[model samples]
Target: MGLSPKSKRRLQRILPFGVIWFVIGLFVLFIQEAATGNKNINPNVVITLTPKVFVFAMISVTIIGLLVGAVEILWLGKLFNNKTFYKKIFYKLSFYTFFLVLTIIIVYPFAASIELGLSPLNELVLNKLSNFLISLDFLSTLGSIAVSLFVSLFYSEISYNVGDSVLMNFFTGKYHKPIQEKRIFLFCDMKSSTTIAEQLGHIEYFKLLKAYYSDFTNAIINHSGAVYQYVGDEIIISWKFEEGIKNNNWINCFLAMKQDLHKKANWYKNNFGLEPTFKSGFHVGEVTTGEIGTLKKEIIFTGDVLNTTARIQGLCNSHNVDILISEELIKELKPDNSLEVKSKGIAELKGKEQKMELFTVSRSS
Candidate 1:
């Protein structure tokens, strides 16, 4: 899913904070090192600093931490359909790798320095270098490695929980349980999406489409809507009755989604001067819902309502409208003076004998 403006702003804000805090933490270590009067400090000391090593060590750690933090922020912004399972493993692997390298960079040098410090000044450096190649304690080193792994895992768990909490708050507006019957289905599709893909080539087109899908999916989720599927250019979104009623004021959600699209449009325009647009349709009806399929089960909606929604969306091309909805959906909506919805009158839809009323939503009501 795409990142909300708020979430994006939050990430921008936190990135600087992470950098600042990391620097501050290193400075604190530098102060401690200075007080201890350790002149020849080892860069391999796991989490310590001395006067001679503080500046370089601090810069290294801060840069690495900021890089990792930036990666986390980017990953958080990308909305994966199954984030929970994937993210858990991703965090563990990332933290384990980062801390393992950091520990090696810090501890090995410190151990060598300690051994050398006990010797004469001229022999100190030579002795430490020779001893580093030999007489290293395998058992103690193994224990240190185990401790580092455990610490890294524990730290990752704590950080993940904190990050998840912040992410949930930033992205989710409100939550309501799904109501049994009456609900609305909205489908939005990128026009000539395939044509763009063909022109851009598979790899380039996939990246662009992925970004578009991510943004749209996040918008639906943020608005407490369930994303059903992405069929090529089209995305199907479902809103249950109760949650729809609760979030009847969807102007904010729409604005957020539009802003996201605007960003993508600008990027594409800059690179290829191609502006992408979407056509959307909505319908409200009673539908039975439950999980379908045995091994690869998925939440499925049954009945003609979904099919009708697709038909309504298809009408957009002939009607020359970007967004259209059934009269049934209009009636269910709590009227807003800001929207100018034009009644298109009863129209005969293909494949269905009965006529259905439709409307077109424009900038001006």
Candidate 2:
């Protein structure tokens, strides 16, 4: 799709990082021009540019790109995707600070040492400790920290809201055009949501919902499941045919999600005086995928599969089952020795005339 709301907001935040650097570069360029007379308005005083300037700029750009891109893609990507990591903002800030200093040290001071033979990697220089510390430009390191912090903070928030892959797919417009793709769908909903809401009240209840979904987000990302939508307390998760089927990610996602929440049960109970519980249903089928809407555009799926998955999850309460899967999906899944599947028989889902065969999936205690 063409710049969904979330994508636009994130881009807007990231754009400042680029703009700040561009403006600083321009300011430096102007200062260099005034100092060197590289572009005198008077025709008689035309100063030629030297290769040294080009060499310096190229080195700086290359060093900055390598250092920043390496950390961003490898470290930040993982940190942002893990919802639990946000709870540890101190660690995040510490890493950012350390990375900023380390990157600048390697990119400039340490690199300069290698070329100049002024440090340990080369020949030791006179007053080695003093010279090495003096060689480091604290001003430039601070600048790097300022820019990195802004970018990292913005990215962390966006990744929390959408996700790393979702942010990328949003910008790439991967689902902009409509196409039918076979996929696995898992509809997971909070159990006893009404009672929880009433007990916690509206404002505090929202916090509980947030914490519950955060756990779901972590599990979903861990299993490579893309979040299709969040309806009320229900989270709709999907995966491509290959991704969902291989390694049984579709199956594990629900189980893992349960475990993630269960681990947080005490926190919920202490904070909100209640433990959170949820149920899920899974199915696989073809769905029409496309970007829909304008003011608040979203990548969405439209097909009977989505409805069927929802209905299947609804059966969880009646059947007293935590997870249910359509028989169609079960055929493709090979249950491990510890995992077990029990036939729930045919279920005449809501708004559907056909009675669909269903099965309950569980793990051995």
Q: Pick the candidate with the highest TM-score.
A: 2
Per-residue lDDT over 48-149 for candidate 1, one digit per residue giving the tens place of the 0 to 100 score = 334444555555445544555565445532333245755755655566465645554454454345444543244554444445434333343344434433
Candidate 2 stretches with Cα past 4 Å from truth are 1-106, 109-159
lDDT tens per residue, model 2, 1-365: 36533344445444534444444444555665787567535221121234553355445644453444445445664665555545545555666677666654454434444434456344342233234345433554365455545555655456556755666567778888888899999888888998888888999988888888878866676676888787888888889989888778888888889888999889988999988888889889999988888897777788999889989999998989889999899999866887888998889999999898999878877
* RMSD versus native structure for model 2: 8.3
C-alpha lDDT of residue 201 in model 2: 93
TM-score of 1: 0.55
Tell me each candidate's TM-score.
0.55, 0.68
lDDT agreement of model 2 with the native: 0.70
Q: Give each model's whole-structure lDDT.
A: 0.60, 0.70
Ten contiguous residues with the weakest lDDT in model 1: 170-179
Sequence-dependent TM-score of model 2: 0.68
